[model samples]
Target: MSANRYPLEVDVAIVGSGPTSAAYARILSELAPEARIAMFEVGPSISNPPGAHVKNIGDPAARAAAQRASEGPGAGAATVNSPGEVKAGTRQARPGTFLLTEGYAADGEDGLPVAAMSSNVGGMGAHWTGACPRPGGAERIGFLDDLDALLAEAERLLGVTTQAFEQAPLPQKVRELLAAQVDQDRVAEYRVQPMPLAVHRRPEGQLVWSGADVVMGEATRNNENFTLFDNSLVRRVLTDGAAASGVELSDQLTGQQYQVAARCVVVGADALRTPQLLWASGIRPEALGRYLNDQAQVVFASRLRGVEASQGAGAPGAGLSEQSGVSWVPYTDEEPFHGQIMQLDASPVPLADDDPVVPGSIVGLGLFCAKDLSAQDRVEFDDQVPDFYGMPSMRIHYRLSEADHQVIERAKQQIVRLGHAVGDPLDERPFVMPPGSSLHYQGTTRMGTADDGTSVCSPDSEVWQVPGLFVAGNGVIPTATACNPTLTSVALAVRGARRIAEKLNNSLLMSKSDNRMSE
Candidate 1:
């Protein structure tokens, strides 16, 4: 859509422009074409095609700059200080990947110190590793009646495919060796396949990575009802008698604030910040930022014995060497951890020595175990303090339970066994990373079926008691997942989109009814 005037009312106002926000906006535009929608992104649009994946940029310098841009404003500063006070160095999966933690994280509480976010037009969608595995067995949300349908839609929008490296030799070898390591007793639900990735392979032998742009479709272009406002920071969700009425936003570049009315508000501003926004909006609940979960991640690298690296084979210029193999160990009752193995000819997983690329004869291995969810693990805000963005300050308090430690131990054993099957494990490589290192923080605004104190939002992603206010993104994931949460989070947003469409459809019906009554 051509840009619309400011301060105008919109049917729906979406915060954050990652996969979750994109999913909400896209589905709403499709299901309710007449509903006027506006998406507000806090950071500047970094890409020329705005929201295109950094991997899509061929030049090394351009890609690196875009990645850093996604890292948020503090990353460009001479002295970085997003966490309010800095003690430990800011950590991230890669450059242009993570926004520094704003306010305070329980640096002593293990995982909270490293929990981070990304701020850009596309958010984390522009800089993800593209691992899009589906939940299995217990990892699937049992309450979702339309689980399969939602997942299918999310996968379609992400362009997820198992055949991304169907022709790569290294992946086939890794799958074979990894399969041999899995206990024969649990083979039924624990077999392997090529990694599911949100990527498209063109006939020209180039691969285009999925980002918020891919998910947004033409909503930002041809849809007259949809408008994306970049460099606008939403500070609060305006409410009127238990219902969302609008949002208060400020221009990030100019510091000019605007009061834009919205019939409904949906916040998907990553996990940590989503809850922060809710707190800033004075919608705090007992469960608003409780039950914080970051899956215990164990990373290691191993030398490949028989497999040869196809340097330019599957992923082209992208870091993915051979498509990941058996992207899951399958979260089952007996083995609750998930395993991801990648042949890193030019690897992206950071190892102690490898940095970016593992030797051609090496493969990177990772195991993620679901954390035991507890009320004690949480991220709270101090109304008195202000964050880097001048909002309510955040303080995360998290720790691993005894059961969590047991899970981590078992994950270590599992990865070591699988490592032996592939090659020799590198010294100091096969070890558990600090908490939050995985960057898969979840469950802050977790959903439940009711307005229970244990959940901040309803099962459909609407905040409890706030009828028109909703929350999405990883924060709303109620589960302690073993796989990457992007696909599942996007799927959950699909569910929310359907609910929002119904509300919009009813509003239109009521207008017609009122007109007839007046006549």
Candidate 2:
């Protein structure tokens, strides 16, 4: 857990230090107090003295991930130059596919693969809108009872906060909009709770922020057991056949590599990278890189007349006032991905795709996320598209099915209805409309009854083929729920940690009893 020293051995080795990994580490510490656990992160650890990316808003890690995406199949292609040269950025524009690092996604008519989003450190959680919603009955009917318990466990580990937002003022436009909807019974059954956030909330003046640095950050520096390795990129999982024994990693800064062992291994490296790591390690199942799904997101921007100025897009210090809920109801559809609608309060700052006409304004962003029903969407590893470190990048294959289109239409109609209730005319067109805009990647490695079909892990998240290997995060979701996968992933990781602890305890007891009998 020290910056200067690398841990030689650990009871558990967690590949990612994101929300899921964080939850697993915390649970392991509580359940097995004396068990030595080491959490490895490819990025620089979050310190009291924050990096330039977190402090100055430069976000180097994000830049690297973006670069990796850009160099892949569709988004990054070579173009013929005037002076008899081939260029990297001069080809036909393609919407990057969002998928995993190990599987081959089917190409379009032109035979080019799609690109998916990837990140280091807190991963996607760093750029998330922070809206947490649980899956409905329609989404969970197929799984076992342990899923219900795991979902409950997830809520507890996330410090699910519903009453915390009462102290802050509700945005005037949001309040008016919700009031009108309630009066019309359009949202009669649903209740908006405080958005569940992983970070701790601090009182005003209690913590001082000088630019991007939060001096008294307890989440990162205060925990003695919490060890974070920043700027370290994981290359592959080290294993023998299906059994995972250790992890092979490379330092993003120095390009140094090492192999670290663990009693149990948990992978939380997002939907894309998790599979890639598994594949590189030669741990393959028919389901390893298949069934990749992401929440279809459509972004809408509107200028409000009376709302106060927003700090920026995904502003770290900006206060979230009166968090709202994602209202969803189950409607049985032939589609594989569930349909749900979520309302998010986004800052007016320029995002990745901002309209030229209204680049800067009081923008209220609305994102409608749905699931992908088709199995055609997938991921593949390309040796051609390489990063600075020469590690292969994932070629993501993603496209919206008819189900996604219908769900988007429904969400648009709902938005219009809400506008009419508030005595405001709805805008006819959105700023950027896409099939799978919301980046909630999930369901690549699903949990199932056995190893032959429909699963990479069992009901308890144990790798079906390997005893010590475990899968976590959105990558292992059995079904793509309509809600954000972060909460669900964290919950699954916690449940997995508990199961590991139980197995370990039983094994130790049996060994001790055998020794006593022999004596």
Candidate 3:
């Protein structure tokens, strides 16, 4: 649709076209096919043919060029270079190409920076590694009811499977060798299995998953009522008294401001921006941006000594191949950290016959420990210094607690032990990734059983102060889960969408009844 054809109002207006909003839009559209839905995205709509810039994931130069070409002229550069700017760095993945245009703030105390939230249409889902593990009982939020059903539905929607590379020889042998070193009690407790991934095998047996775009792209494309406004940055939720009336949006290309009147609004703008929008609109609950939490990750890389060069052949870039699989060590009561072991196909070493060991066969182990939700670790909006979108830039204040530090220490010891058991350890010690580098930020707009000032939203993900406003994303997850929070967050969004659908349906019925009475 052309920019002139964009609707002035919608029954449902969703901010942020990430996984959470995509899931909500999918479910709600199915429930009410006749309803008008508008999804606003701050980044370019590059997923479509004209702007398909994500062609090469392995080639950094190609990816960067593609991203730059997609942005066109006048788009600002990415504010963050790497997670290291905020003291957070990732060993497995490099800085994203599309994230170059996004903005983030640095902390004054430790100088650790928060992960740059993607302003693109797909949000962070486009750049994620596709690891989708369900949170265990210990990791689930205590107040979230119907957890089992929600997870099941979420799994179905994500097409999660645990057999992506189950038949791989190297990963199997590594797991077996590692299990032999640990006692049966500990082995059973940890329960290492094939990592659950949101991917599917093609007819030629290649694994692929195109994030939320694949999940709901067809639905949005087919449904004319569902409209997408890309390169539209949402400034704030326009509220009338205690109720949300619409949203103020800015065209990133033209720098034109517009209002999108909505009967109901859902904000899935990630952890930082979600609260920033709320705070910008003067909806400052005490816990609006407090209780921020992200998994504390520790990463270690090792080379598999004595492995034949031929055996490590065909490993795809960014690690997993037909011959190698990824393993997950779920969080247990005894060990409160989630662990993963995967082959790094993007290792810097070259594969050659002369070398004693196979090059590019570096296996990486990652430990993600759940951090306690604390008010002290939060995001502050600096309205004085506006970003390119003319909104307040964020300043993150995050510090690892004593418990988090202890978990990292324990995880380091375990990584060393496993390294010796699997292969020759390369680095002197494992590197502790900076906080927020995990890209699993949660608990900012947490849902609670009550509307107390401590919680930003109710159990149904409805804002306590706003009747027709809702929130969906990782920020709504109240628990500090060690596992990847994407699936859990999507599950919560599904639940919220159902509630919103029911409310909208009931309102429609009431309007008809009132019209009949007036006649």
Candidate 4:
């Protein structure tokens, strides 16, 4: 189908539909009750998670079988996406495994990194482990205290359930093992308990908790002002002169081009896709696609012999209880959000790909997230590789710094100490890698005041180059804090949506006043 000839108008246009899109849409609806919004997603609705991302169809019925057997709702959502029968080169290739784009070959000498984006109603949130953490300390520079109010609003709109965690049906041993990480000195060192998440926990059950699926459906979907368009991939911004006026999109399912004009545009494509969208639209700034950050991850695996197989929603092992200048969860400081400590409740066998080895035994994964490397790396559009839609695909060029390595090394030592605290038998060795070797990549279109020339958005997350355009998600984050970026992304979206509504409301009131004066 051809492009919509007349301007398809709305009060706001949200580019992506992850947690950011849903949360912001709620805020906009409340603040501007009469305002119309256009929410576009390049994937299917929540009803069919598999159809949303083609990769979820791996082995055809494999995912469905797994989901039926597993406690997690959508555990079996991926379908292997490789050509033919899963050959050596195609084993890991699955439809929702990573974001896919059809566009130009990247500009880098080595070419762009594999760029994967979630194509679902909830976008990446659908595949997420439901980790929700707010940025603290240095990471709070770009965002103001007004963010707290926004966060509260997000919690309500997103239906975040705190009581959910208390109810997870976890195994007894799993609970003890995770809680043990916070004994005495360990608590003193970290100064916090396990990080609170957005997942719904079944407090009285066997310790099992579903992720964020509880509040996302039906309830929030009831808003009449909130409209969602699935299977619609955004192509580029429709601009007037240099300012963004709206967006041009292609309905992936039907091969149709459409446009949604808004007085304001909000880009919430997360860290990976947000930068490329800005660049594709000619929104330039020193930091548009620079300072690419990711957490460096290392894992230590072993098995607890006496522990029975995991049956319930396992408590996230001390899950997110520790933080330092270089590390947050199982990742380190060198790569910013790179290091993450994953305490997976599972058995261990020798396997490869990404993940560190403990050298012996089976149990759980003690992931080490390293520090953030404040290096200048980035994502941009490759002029050569074009997708079926003919838009430029993203090209990413990134690496870690020496500071990142030291953080990982220190993390290994801490992992050993943590093992001791939990009284678990563990191998004292750790696997290693180059900084940024593990992807949790973020921070391309950072937000800051005008004084910080590297930033593309203001403190309020408004794009400097395009006044009406705002950015939410990891792309606009000034720093990659030790926590997962989703909660903060939602918070920022709420904040930005309020700003958009206020501006539009003021504009309408002024226009009406002028009309009356003219009469």
- Among these predictions, the greatest lDDT belongs to 1
Alpha-carbon TM-score of each model against the true structure:
0.91, 0.73, 0.87, 0.74
Sorted by TM-score, highest first, which candidate order results? 1, 3, 4, 2
Off by over 4 Å in 1: 1-5, 77-93, 98-108, 187-189, 308-326, 345-347, 351-360, 516-519
RMSD of 1: 3.9
Q: Write the per-residue lDDT of candidate 2 for residues 364-384, one digit (tens) a residue.
A: 334444465445566666666
Off by over 4 Å in 4: 1-7, 46-95, 99-115, 161-192, 201-220, 304-363, 366-372, 423-439, 511-519
User: Cα RMSD for candidate 4?
Assistant: 7.4
The CA lDDT of each predicted structure is 0.78, 0.53, 0.71, 0.53
Predicted model with the maximum TM-score: 1
lDDT of 3 at 289: 81
Write candidate 3's Cα lDDT for 205-309 as tens digits: 556554677546466568888888888888889888889888988887787778888988999988878998998888888888888888877777677766776
Better structure of 2 and 4 per lDDT: 4
Instruction: Give the candidates in order of lDDT, highest first.
Output: 1, 3, 4, 2
Better by lDDT, candidate 4 or 1: 1
Candidate 1 on 1-519: residue-level lDDT in tens? 134346479899999999899999889988888999999998878885667777777778877777677767457644332211221344533566554455335556564555667778988888776778888877788898888889999998787888866765567777777888884767565676666888765466665677888788875456798888888889999999889999999888778778888999999998888999999999998998998899888877787675444443344555344444334456666788887776653334443344343344567788889888898888888889887788887787888988999999888888888888877777543577667767788999998887769999887999988989999999898887888889999999999999999999999999999999999
